[model samples]
Structure formats: structure tokens, C-alpha cells
Target: MSDQESSTSTSQTEGEVEGELDEEVDTEMEGEGEHDSKHRDSPPLQISSFSSTLRAVIRIKQKYHALKKRRQEAEGDGALTGATGRTSPKIFTFDGTTPIALSVPQKKKRKRRRRVMYPNRGKRRAPPKPARSRAKYCLYLLFAIVFVQVYNAIENLDDHLLRYDLEGLDKTLRREVFGQQGAVEGLLSHLKEYLSTYVHNKPWCCPCTAPAGVGKSHLGRLLAGHFRSVVETLVLQYYVLHHCPQEADALQCARDLSALISEIVERAEEEEKIPLFIFDEAEHMHGEILDVLLQLVSSEQTNEYLNAIYLFLSNLGHSHITKHMLHNSSSTSMAKSGRYSHFVKELTPILRNTLEKLHVLWTEADILPLGLLEKGQVMECFLDEMTREGFYPDHTNIERLAGEIEYYPEVGGHEYSQTGCKQVVAKVNLL
Candidate 1:
């Protein structure tokens, strides 16, 4: 009976140990279930975990693409191929089940190609040029400037005064100065003597008095042409002292005359050329201007070079000269005895007196009287003019032209035309 009772106690102790182990297992299973239920009930915790895992996957993909791109660029090929001839490994997510293809960034194409080789590459260029070369360039530029200036000076030196044809003077005289042969020859002789004095450096002044259309200006121009090399003609009527409407007042005219005289004096001094100042229509000039002219011509200092000639042309003493001729030539015998010369001598003092009364600066010695032209001389002039103009007129035409010309007793009766030789050419044109 003792042995049976020990065996029964051992069996009871084994049963009790098994029951405690079962209870511990049941409690652990309940705690695991509660943890799983809390995880399911809170969605924020699950989302946070999933987001963190997704971010980790994205980061891993970026790293893989960067590495692949670098390798491909180094190998000069696509991301799938490597420099070592091996394919690039594919990337995966954390689960290793989902494959991830990280796209490698492409390189932009270059607009311009870079040169791989150059002829003078890796070598320094030549040193700066020498100063001697720069100086030579400067000298060339200076020489060009000097050459241009010398060329301009040569051009200026070629300048000359404008003058009329001298060869036509004889033709003009034969055609125009018909019956005034004695008067013209006498005047020309006086001019020759005057020019001789001028050549000896003696200044001269002359006043030529004549009726209108008696060829005073024409004669003056002929004389000017004769001595063109020494004479510079200034026609007052055409120049600053003209009778145009735009002429300045008397005072201004005097000023202009002064300026012109000063310029002429300076030019004469510099160029050694004589100035023949011809005052045409002297009657139109104011007495003040005439006085200024007289002062200019009379001044010894102004005419120091004897390079001036003042020739005053006017009709101022025409009537007096005509009357003197008429009174002295009352008879044909008296007229043929060179009575005009005597009359001129007689008229000098009278002209001086008249000029003095008029406050004129000129004296009787300056008077060079031009008389009326003859009818025969007028006919000769008309015929000469017709020949010069290429016209062959018949005797009837010549007679008609002669009849058209009017004669005035005041101008030496039939010896001179009323308009002198001025209208002779025009009347011939009408025929």
C-alpha cells in the first residue's frame, strides 16, 4: 500500500505544472491581439510609417539615377551601358518586389562646337611692335598733310585777274569811234604820256568829259586792255559806287569808297600792280564822295608806289566844251586851223572856275574833252559794224540807217549824231 500512494502524489504534481504553463500562454496571446487592434484603430500612425518608407524609396531612386548618369557620361554612352562593358543594375523598393526605373537626366545639346585642336595652341603670341614702326606711320601721315598743303598753295599761285580780249580793241574802235578820230588819237596820246609817267612811278589823275553815247567808257575799257598787265580796272558804276537802288546812303558810300581805296592801296603795295580807278558817270557821285576820292588820289603816301590812276568820266563840262567849240569855229577856216585845241586851252580856266563853284575836287588840268562825231565818221562806223556782224547791207539799207540817225545842232550840227555812236548799231539792226 505505501508504494501505490507515492506514485499517485507524483502524478498530481505533474498535472499542476501543465495547468500553470497553459494560463501564461493564454495571457501573452491576448496582449498580442490588443496590440494589433490599436494599430488598426489609429490610421495616422500607419500613414506616417508608409510615407517615411515611400520617401526612403524615392531618395534611394534619386541616388541610383545620379550614379547611373555619372557612369554613362564618363563612358560616353546611355545609362544601361557602362565603360567596362557591363549593364547597369536595376534599382528596387524596400520590399524588393517592385522594380524602380530611375530616369537619368539628359544633357543639353551645345549650340557651338568646341575646337579640339588649334595650329598655335599652348603657345604664346608675338611681343608688342617696336616704336620705330609707329614713328614711321606718324611720319607718313605728316608727309601726306604737307604734300596736300603744298598742292593747295600751287593751285592758289595759278590764280590771275579776269580780263577782256585785247585784240578786239582795234576792231571796236574802227566800228564805233567813227568821226572822233582826232579826239580819240589825242586822248590816246595823252594816255601814252600818262602811262609813261606811271612807269616812272608817278601817279596820274585825269577827268574825261563828254556827252552821252560818246564812247567814254568804251575808250576807257580799251585803254585798260592796252595796259592790263600793269592796270587793274575798277569800274565805279559797276562796282561799289553803282547807281543801283540797293546803294547805301552818302555816308555809307564814302565809307565803302574808303575801304575800297585802302584795299587797292594795300594790294598795289603787295603785288606791285597799278590800280586804274575809273569813276563812270561822275555826275552821279556826291561831292563828299568825290572829295574823298580826291583825297585818296592826292595823298603822296597813298600813291607812294605810283600804282594808282584816277580817271573820272562824266558829262559835267559837256555843254561848256560844246559852246567853246561852236564859238571858236564860227568859220570853216577857223575850224580847219585846229581851233578846238585853242578852244580847249581857253576852256581850262573856265572849267576850273565852274568846278570850284560846284565844290568839285577836280581842276582844269584833269579835263580831257571829247567832242561831237562827224556824219561821215558815223556812216563809216555803221558800215564797219555791219561788216563785223556778218551783214552785207545794200546802199539803200545804209542810207535808211543814216536817215534814222538824228543829228543835233548842240552836238556839232551834222558832224555828230544826237546819240553819238551809241544808237548807230541799233539803227543798223532795224534796217
Candidate 2:
């Protein structure tokens, strides 16, 4: 039995050992299969020396340089073709499964050229700015045209006064009138302003107020004569003392005066001329005559009356004028300096006020007060009279004739003549 047991044990041990051996073989085979599988899944290990690695690196650099060179050449060709207006084909390369654009080369940095400044660079005119719009130029031209037209219109407004030879009249007044410089200038200035234009809001009404023998009547005669010479038919020299004296019927005189003025104005209007009406010794005009004259000179009159110039030579404010002239005689220096305008300005209101007390007509009149004549002006008057009378004006005789004329301020040296140049013609004739 023991022997049989021994044999079974031995057989079992042997079978077990065989089985273990087979299991070891199977594990070795499985490890070998796994090693094959890992070798297949992973990349193979490479062994290299430094020199071989450097050589491989050089070859890779060479390949990369070759690709960059090809890309640059392709880009240059594309640029050249693009400049010629030709379409360029894209160059692409495949690395395994991915494609790369090799025609698009890395941009090279451009070399900048040094700037060269020429001496005349700043002096060169910049391109001309675009021309101003034609509408702007047209606007400027229109403005200039409007300005010229307005200027011409303003100048033409004074043509009427110039046409009447006002400069010549001014020269005559200055040359003929003596010691009445203020009066003459005031009268001329007003006339020039009034006659500068044909259209007026009212007629030109001037009152010459002065004492007797102060050239009031002479001034009126000079004006009347000038107007008669220029416009003989249009000039009316009406003498209140002669034409319609105090004894005449006032109403009848008024009627005749109105009819005469109407006829003269109508005729002058037809001729396109301004009429002149000189009322001599207006202080003697009857109330009825004054009323008619007032109506003619009133601003309420018809348009025809506005085209006429009316002058009233009177002694209405003679007392006030004489007193003012005497008081201002010492200040003749202002008159000598050609600044006697203020004297007339100062005396105008006085004369107007004095005359207005008699009639409101004077309120509308431009007052021209005749100041006292200087001794020198009286001498000039004498010389002028002598010359007009066809006699040689000797200065000695002129001085002698001027000496006979009474002067104001009897105590002091004679400065102003008492009677101005009114009596100069008579005195010269006596001489």
C-alpha cells in the first residue's frame, strides 16, 4: 500500500510541476506578446552620437532654409505678377495630414532711405488751395456793385446844386459881400443843402435880419440880381413898401401876391427850375400879405411850393442884431479866424424869436443875422464900389472914405462900421 501511495504522490507531483512549467511558459509568452504590442504602440528609441545629432540638425536646418527660400521666391513672383495685374496661384505644402501656406513668406524689414532736405523746399509754394466757390466770388462782386451804386447815388444827390454853378455863386458872395461873412456863409450853406436835391420836405425859407444901412437891402439886391441873371423869369423881387405899401388894400395885395407866386412856381416847375422869391422890407408887409406869404412858405403847401426858395430881407429884429453885434465886436478875432459860424448860430434864435412875436411865419425861416462890418471890410466895400464905378480905387481915398463911415464904441479905436457897406456906394460916389 505504501509503495502504491508513493507512486501516486510522485505522479501527482510530476503533473503539478508540469502544470507549473506550462503556466510559466504561458506567462513568458504573454509577456513577449505584451512587449511586442508596446513596441508597436510606442516610437522606436534611437541611439546617436553628438556628431550624428549635429549632422541631423544641419540637415533639418538646410531643409527649413530650403522651404523659406521657396516661400520667398513664390512671394516675389506673386508680387511681380500682381504688379502686372495678373492673378497669382497660392503655393501650399503638406506636412503629414496638415497643409501649410508656403507662398506667404515672413515679411522682411524695409530699409528706410535718409531724408534729403533741399534749400528751396520751404520756399516751394504749396499746391494752390482750391479756388473759392464761384458763388462766393459772385457774392463779392455783387457787394462791390451795390457799394458802387450806393456811392454813385450819394454823389448824384448833390448834382442839382452843382449844376446851378453854386461854386461860382459862393465865390461871388465871398468876393462881393463885406463884413457879412457870417451871413453869407450861413445863407450859402443853407442854399447848398436845400438845392442839393430836388425833393424836399418843405420850401427853403431864410430871413435876413439886420438894422438899416447894414447891407440887408444890398444883400437882397445882390441875391435878386444873381437869380435874375441866371433865371430872369423865375426870380421875383417884391418890395413890400413899393409893390404893396401900407396904404394899399391888404386883401388885394395878398391876392396879387398869391397869383404872382402861383404863376411863377407853375412856370418854374414846368421848366424844372427852382424859383427865387425875394421879399424886400418884409417888416412893412401887411397882415393879409404876410398871411399869403406864410401859406406859400408853409410845409402844408402843395409839392410845387417845396421847389421854391423864399428870402425875407427885413429890419424886424434889427435892434437885437445890432445889440448882439456891438457886444460881440471885441471878439472879432473869432471871425477873422473863419469861425464866425457860431456867431450866426448864437444870433439865429434871437432873431427868430423876435420875429416870431409878430408872426409865427418866422419860426420856419432860417435866420441869417448880418453882423457889424469891420473897418477893413468897410474899406474893401469902398474900393469895390470905386472899381464898379469905373474909377481907380486909390487906397488913400478908400481909407478916407472908410474913415467917414461911423463906427461903434465911439471911445475906443474904430473896429466895426455902424452902417456896414450899405452906404459904401453912396460914400464912394460922393468921393
Candidate 3:
């Protein structure tokens, strides 16, 4: 039943019960009145009936209270019909009219909050590094290539130098050829510098000027022999007095000399070799012969003519060289730098002037003067010759042999040998 209809029916039932109780009370009261008229004669029986009536009224009141409690429980159940298993609502009256029901609030199921994770937090980050430049790497590569090229060029130059055997040549010159340290040094400097490379712009011409019997011819022969040993058939030792002795043979001599030089230079160029040409007694060479040599050694010649060494051993400036040596014999300055260099420096122009008067061919030549030999050098030559002849000569015998040779400025303490070492070999043979 609906809550409102049921409550109304309950109220109606309670009113009907109260009306029946009232009717019963009224009937009992009427009976009491009638009994009172009759029971005036019996009072005790009337009193018992009134007590019984009071108990009956009390029982009726208890029953009514029990029914009212049951009705209130039913009303509560009806109010919460759709929403079961909930606690009973508390009753609160408003303005003394109707009760307001307040239900207990259910707690909501709390959703689990997700935890967020952050990476590398609280620390400062470094900036990105820059890359290396391409130009730097390119420059390093260029340096490496240049270094390799320079090293290779040096190796090639050393290879070219090995063919000449310059060390052996220098040793031979120093050992066998004495009293010409300056000449040897100058000659080797030129040779080493020239032979280090195969390319050349002009021929090397060294004109040796000295007096007779002062080892000019010996120096020429030594060079010829050394070069021949190394270069085989490419060395030429030409003697002007021996080859073209007469003026009548001048034309023929010029032609022959030109052909020979042309053949040597052509052959040397083809072989990538430097040829040696020694002209003994160059002062006696005919004008036509000089012209031929001049053209061959000229800087204007073809490339093939530029890789030859020309040695002209001549007595052209013997008087001037001998006079300079004698004049400077007492000077300590000339002795310090070696007499050969001093002669070359002081007399090269003088020799050049003298040669130009005869022929311009010699003006371009490198003048290497041979100074007068000292008495001590002559003595060493004596000892050398004696050793070669299988004679173990003592210092006394060496002095005696050197004493036999003539010296100039007889009264001076520093006398020079007049004939150099020219007569030493003959004298040592006599011993």
C-alpha cells in the first residue's frame, strides 16, 4: 500500500477503537447508575466492579502504543523502498508540521591519480660542440704532399751525385796532388755543385794558369786519369803542342777538334753523363781552334753542349803569377788563406785581360792560378817519390834530395822552390 494511504487507514482504525472504548465506558457507567439505585442495600459489590473497570482501561492504552510503534516502522520501510541496505534516516520536524528525512551520504570511490616521471631534471644542459673546418684538413694534406715531393727531389739529387764518385775524387785529389789545397778546394766545389744535377745552362770552363814545372801538367794528367777511371771513354786529354803543333794545321785542327767535342757532348747527353775535356798547353792553340772551343762552351749553344767540363792548362800568365807569389811571400795574410786563392783573387782579372788580347774564348773561363811551391812542399814531394821507388829514405836523405833542387831569393828564410816538384821524380830515380 502507498505510505500516505496506509497512514490514513491506520489513523481511521485508531479512531474507531477509541469510539468502541467510549461506548463500552458509557454502558458500564449506565449499569453502575442502575446498580447504585439497587445496590444502596449492597455497597461492597459495587466497589469491586469499579476497580475491574480501571484495569480494563489500562490494557487498552498499552495496546494502542504498541500499534503506533509498528505503524512508524512500516512508514520508514515504505520511504526507503527503492534504496535498500541503507541506514534508517533520522526524523527532523519542520515548523511542527511534517518530518524531514536526511539519509547518510555515501563516500565516492576515489580514482587513483597517475604519477608523472620527468627525465634529467634540475641539472643544467651543455651546448652542442662545433665541428672541425674542412680548410684545416686540406692545409695539412697539402703540407704532407709538399714534404714528400721535396724529400723525393733530394733523393734523386743524391742518386745523380753517386755516378760521379765525388768522395773518391776528393780523396784522390787531396792524397796524390799536394801543395795546391786552394786549387783542389775550388775545383771540387764546382764539380760537386755541377754533378749534383744533370740539367745545365752552360759548360764549366776552368783555365789553370801557372809557371812551367809547377805541376800544371801534372794536375791536368791527374784529372784526366780520375775522370777516365770513372767515366771510361768520355774523358778527352787534348794537347795543343802534340795535336796541332803547326800553324798550317790550324784549319784541320779546328775541324777535328770541333767534331771530337760535338761527338763527346752528343754522346754524354744521350747517356745523361758529364764529359771532361782537358786541353794541355792551351796558350799554343790556334785562333781557329780557339774559335771552335769558344762556340762549344758558349751559353748560347744547344742544351747538349752545356754538360761538359773544360780544363785549360796553360803557361800564359806564368810570369805574373810567379811575380805575385814572390812579392806576397813575406806577407802573413796570403799564407793564412792559402796562396792559390790569393793568386786567383788578385790575378784573375789580370789573366783575363791578357787572354782577351789574344782571344775572347778565354775571357769567360774560370781562372784558377797555381802559386809557387814552398820549400817544405818540395821536400814532401821528394819523400813521396822516394817511397814510390821502393826506397825507405830517412828525413836526412829527404832533406838532401830537396836541397838539390833550386830555390829563389836565396837569402830569404821563406824560399820557394824554383822548379816545384818537377825534378823530384828524376832525382829520386837517381837515388
Candidate 4:
């Protein structure tokens, strides 16, 4: 049963046993004294209670021994280490009286039992963490969407650029009727930005010298494609005169120039629009044709009526032309004659003044020593193109290729290393 009920029953049993023992002791003493002849007038009921007590004395002794053994065994296991400190409880009388008041085991007062409130004490004002629920997930999703949009925009822009390049090639072919598209594109890309920016301000000109097979002509074709509709082409290959096989060759060259100019003049007359003239390999212009072309530019019809754009392309270096004998002797006639009549730098005197008046732009390497694609731009282009192909580009590889392209066969010229596209393909495979 429960501890409290068991304790009460045990206490009652012990009291009954002790009371019977006391009575037995008294009866024995009385019996011995009465048998001799003294102390006879004791109550019969007292005698009966005394006799019953004596009979129960043996049972009381046995119960005491049983309880003591049980208590000692319990103590051996450390279970009886209660507050009493006694190995066994003392037996006492019944009738709600103690034979000796064995003091009720004092409950040890544990310093007013200060119950510590450990968990709940510091809980009141702690600021709430994670103020935005599921915010990390939202942030990640937003970033993912932004990244995707940016990637798409870049991809579309690149496609636009490549298509523009191809179109430029076609235009170059249509106008020059000579040269390949790739080299032309390479050349034209350099001047495109400046041309668009200064369309009204400057006459376009890019004078780059290249070996015959290096594709300067092709680059010119690229320009023709680039200018497709924005600027009309009126090309006059003046050098054809120097190598003309017959009189008809000169006549045909004139016809070509006339046809080209006539087409533009007709358009301007019809649409009231100005035209742009492209003179590729302008250095080839000989004495007679040079004078004709100069006359064309100087004419009010070309300058005011047509509102022309003159773009002179050539491979002849400006320094060489100023110092060379060929351009000086027969190409031009100085306005003011002298007795000595020295053949000065005729191309400069002729071109500088004419081009300034018409705002013809000569794409001068002297002006842009650096290519359009700077080192940083090249690196970015490389990484971006490579990454799109699912390859991680190595900076070391790019640097090596850039170094290879820093010098071309020409003394001061640098060729683009697109021929090394194969090498880039191989490196990307390694990644």
C-alpha cells in the first residue's frame, strides 16, 4: 500500500504488542507476589486483561524479531536511511498513547526550502530573433531570378552584335567588290564607335597599312556592310589609273566614279538627303584622277548640295607619304608656284586642306594607337564567350594568346588572334 497507510498500521501493531508485553510483565510479578500471600484484592477484570496480555507476550516478541530482521535487511541495501537515523523503529503502546513518546521524526527544515526558479527567470524581454520569417528563402529566390534575367539580356545583346558584324561584311562586299569580310570586320569595329558618335562632326577616315594578303581590302568590305543604309558608298579606286592597261581603263574608271556619284546625286535630289563617299586605297589616286576627285569634293554640288561624307582608306603610312617621293612629284600641284618649285609633301597639302573643309574622317592609327578591344575588354569578351559554351576560361591561357597577338608581321601593326580560336576550343575542353 501507500507509505502513510503502511506506517499507521505498523505503528498500531507495535503498540498492541508492547501493551501486551507490559501486562505480561506485571502479571508475572503479581503472580509471584500473590502466591506467597500478599496483594490479593486486585480487580478480576484487571486479572483477565493481565492474563490475556501475558498470553499475547510470545506473539509480540515474535513480531518484534520479524520486524527487526526486516528493518536490518532493508538497511543493508541503504533503503532505511530515512530521517529517523535508527536501524529499527521503536515499538509503542496502543489506544492513541505512546508508551514513550518516540518523537515524530522531525522533518529537516531545509533553510525555508528556497525553491529556485531557474528556467522562467530570464525569459521576459529577450528580443525576438528571425524577425522576418522564411526571409532567407525569399532572398535566395529573388537572387536566382535576377541572375537568370541578366544572363538572358547578355545573350541577346551578343547575338545582336554578331549579326551586325555579318551584315557589315555583306555591305563591305557590295561596295568594294573586293576583300574578304573577316579582316574587314576586324578593321571596321575599331572605327564604328567613333564614326557613329562624330557622324556630323568629322569625315570618317581610317588609314591602316597592311601587307597585301593581310586583308585590308576585306576590312573595307566590312565597312561597306556597316554603313549599309546609314551612309551611302561612292567609292573611287583612283589607283586603277596608274595600272590602266588602255585608254578604256581610264574611261571605265571615270564611268565608275560617275555612276557612283550620279546614283548618290539622284538620291539626294529625290530625297533631299546628303551622301557619304568611300575612297578605299585613296593613296592609289594618281595625278589626273586625284585632281578630278579633289574637284568633286571642292564643288558646291558635293559640299553643299550633296552634304557629303568622305572616308579615305589607305595602307600608306602618313609619315612615309610626307617623306616619300611618289606622292610629292605627280600627285598634286601647289597653288602658289615658286622659281625653285620644290616637290613638297603633296598628299598632306592636298588631303589636309580638302579633308578639313569637307570634314572627311581618315581613321588614323596615329589617332587611335590602341584597338577598340582593350586588354580588359578582351579578357571580359573571352571569359563571357567561353562561359557561354559551358567552359571555365583560364586567365593564363587568355594572357598567353593576347601576348601572341601583340605583334604582327608588320613593324607596328598588331593582328587579332581569332586564328587561335582553335586553341581556345582546346583549352575549354581541358576545363
Give me the candidate number with maximum TM-score: 3
Candidate with top lDDT is 3
Model 4 segments beyond 4 Å from truth? 1-223, 231-251, 300-306, 318-394, 406-431
lDDT per residue, candidate 1, 1-431, as tens digits? Answer: 13443354334434443454445445555655575577777665567666765675566556556655654464455223522323333353365234446779999997997877544866966778866667889999999999999887655433322122223444555445545555555555554445432233445677778777777877776566555543443322323345422435776777777787777667666755556676777777775687677666654553543556677777877888666655544433222226556655787777777766775467534676777655555676678779878789566677678767777564324345667678877876765
- For candidate 4, write residues 18-119 as lDDT tens digits: 676567667765775565355356434456666765676676577667765765564455434543323245565465553445558888776776786555
List the candidate 2 regions with Cα displacement exceeding 4 Å.
Answer: 1-128, 331-339, 410-414
Poorest 10 consecutive residues of model 3 by lDDT? 82-91
Pairing residues by index, what is the TM-score of model 2? Answer: 0.67
What would the per-residue lDDT of candidate 3 be over residues 182-267, giving only the tens digit for each residue?
78788888888988988899989988888777688988888888888888889999999999999999999999989998998888
Tens digits of lDDT, candidate 2, 255-285 = 9889999999999888778999999988888
TM-score against truth, every candidate: 0.52, 0.67, 0.68, 0.30
Q: Is 2 or 3 the stronger prediction by TM-score?
A: 3
Model 4 worst lDDT run, 10 consecutive residues: 363-372
Q: How does candidate 1 fare on TM-score?
A: 0.52
Would you list the C-alpha lDDT of every candidate in the order shown?
Answer: 0.60, 0.74, 0.80, 0.45
- How does residue 244 of candidate 2 score in lDDT? 76
Ranking by TM-score: 3, 2, 1, 4
